[model samples]
Target: MTQPSPLSDRRVVLAVAVLCCFLWGSAVPALKIGYGVFGIVPSDTATLLLFAGVRFSLAGALLLGYALATGKPVGLDRRTLGRVSLLGLVSTAGQYLFYYVGLAHSTGVKTSITTSSSTFFSAILAHWLYTNDKLTGRRLVGCLLGFAGVVAVNLSGAGLDLAFSVLGEGFILIAALLFSLGGIYGKRVSGQLDVMVMTGWQLGLGGLMLAVAGLATGGHLGGFGWEGVLLLAYLAALSSAAFALWALLLKHNPVGSVAIFNCLIPVFGVSLSGLVLGESFLEWKNLVALALVSVGIWLATARKDSVVGRPSP
Candidate 1:
């Protein structure tokens, strides 16, 4: 069979991004399911941490395995390794710990909405940290729009179990902060190590750290079942693969473009929630909010005077 053209490969990349969005979007629901099967919901602290810890641990190990199989597990210089470690601590540990725990407190939709703000936070953080990543009026507007989208989502969830209280929103917001720091660190190290190697180290080492923290915090490790395996599998494969792709994109592409796609998190989150949880489908408010988010993402990520877009998709 003939190889596909470059255009086709580009299409493939967009397709992969969409898939990554979907999988990442579905992560909260998977956490919910973990609560059900393993009894690890809000009431079960030990199990909840275990749920996050074990899945992350396995995911990290798997990525490391890939690194080893590819023959370069230790590819970073000491300085780069230090950066990766710091990023892993902040992004993977600080971010995901709160995120998963927040998932325990909120619904799939709420989690998505809050986590979706990572893009907005990342935009600001990138501009602050990276001199080349200065933001324009569009970017600022986009960040505001995305924030408005979160407000819209919370308003929509007023009566639902997924409703966002200040506490829940706070958790998600903290997660976003950690993610932004991690993303910035990733940007710095993107040139140093292979994406796969960096991911493996980050995930593997970070996961190990979380496991130790989980154990110390009395996070249970029991309740192994099919659900545990499935949750672990989903977290390991889908999440890791998307992140690796993201790291690759961040390595080779612009931060703004990748950041713009952060809006897709809520879209996929709401979509998966409806399909998987029987939540009501889209409402007019959601549509309006989505439009705002779209405009915001465009402004935040796109160039100001130069109409040249990031590579299509």
Candidate 2:
């Protein structure tokens, strides 16, 4: 197999990272539409799990199929299997379990803002886990700017709420933390395993667990239709592509560098929600938020010597 270029190649990293974040951003609206098509109300915990289980399981299958077709090795050693399964559990099943329930209890705006905290978690974790990815002033400023953009974009819809719930905001934070940990762990695993293969197995194993739990709890989609199936398929494809690419990126880049892109997810989510759900798209804050996010990405990812297109010192 040909060795891929280092993620320090700014152009390739930016393109792939943007694509991954855009796919994830689209999921926000896609999932909202999916819930309606599948007749899953906010209170439908079991059905939500069932829906997510199906989506992820299918995504795993698609990734594995792609790997086989592309002649990538699909076999994993027993130890690798165990590690990948653990990664899947924390990253996919556990993260989404909390996320779905939390989103159900909280508003979409709040969910987006809270989940954006994962970048902070990842940056902090990387400082401890990776010597090369130490926390720096530039990275901190970038993360804060991106976080502010997230807050700015959601400000219109997120009316002040003094009340907070453990199940609502708390779970979202937990999911964010778990997601950060999962990214770090995934980087470790990808060093030894093929990125696609690792992603496929973990998603399959974790998704199977979710399916079993949902089924055991009497989860079933009501009024299943062709539209619902198609949407589910779309979601699965997004997961397979985004996660595999993400794993690959994390394997080659500093965790903080790649993790900073997570801030883009909510930006894409808000913009898409406006277009798809007929919300106002002309808000001034939206533009400001995007500008801030752009600056944030630049600051976080740009090499010190390359800041002004200068060669390394």
Candidate 3:
């Protein structure tokens, strides 16, 4: 097979990655609506877990249905099942469970800013784990650029207090760690299974786990108003659709390098939140923070052989 030129491959991956960011970013504002509209009046943790449960369960079921109708062979072998299970737990279940809860405690902008730190966190963990994909000099420069945007969005203006919300930040940090774990496990199990089938298994199992957690926490399930239903559909469709695309990209492209696209989440998420949720957009500190995150993303993922900062060259 004469491989297609690298430029074409990069273009495809970049397009998919940006789409994923857009979907996820768009979902954040919808999520705020979900929290407000849902009738299950649980505390923050249970409420967030409930949202994760509903979203993942809907996504998982839809994927499974698609796989079955298409004859995609969705079940995993024993060993692969274990690996996928772990990946589901770390990447999807753990990460978003924490993320939703954190969102309740912080503003959309703050949560988005905190999430950008995932690249920094992943780089450190990927390095410590002796992961083969070491950060290149250009990648570092890009990540630092991205991190600068993070700082500008988080703490670079007069109204922005320097006081760190450890609780909010800590949840996102954990989400980042879980994301790294998923990527690490992906390195091991990726080639062994069909990507779509693997995604079905991961989403299905992760959805189950989140549902169980929601049950354990006594998540309330009521209030089927139009707004609630709309938010639910939004979370399930937008977030999960994008995630499926993301999983496909990870399957076909460079894993660690692809992870850098996560930095775009804050950029998209914050902007969408401002427009849709009436979140503020004019803060000078936020501009600086955004710039820092953009820089950090650049430092975190820039490469020498590419015109754009994508996983492929």
Which one is best on lDDT? Answer: 2
**lDDT by residue (tens digit), candidate 2, 183-220:** 89988888788889889987887788788778888899
Residue pairs in collision within model 1 = 46-220, 138-299, 139-300, 142-296
Off by over 4 Å in 2: 1-6, 157-159, 304-313
Ranking according to lDDT, highest score first: 2, 1, 3
Score candidate 1 by TM-score against the native: 0.80
**Which 10-residue window of candidate 1 scores lowest in summed lDDT?**
304-313
Best by TM-score: 2
How does model 2 score by TM-score? 0.93
- Candidate 1: how large is its RMSD? 5.5
Instruction: Specify the poorest-scoring 10-residue window by lDDT in model 3.
Output: 304-313
Per-model lDDT: 0.68, 0.85, 0.67
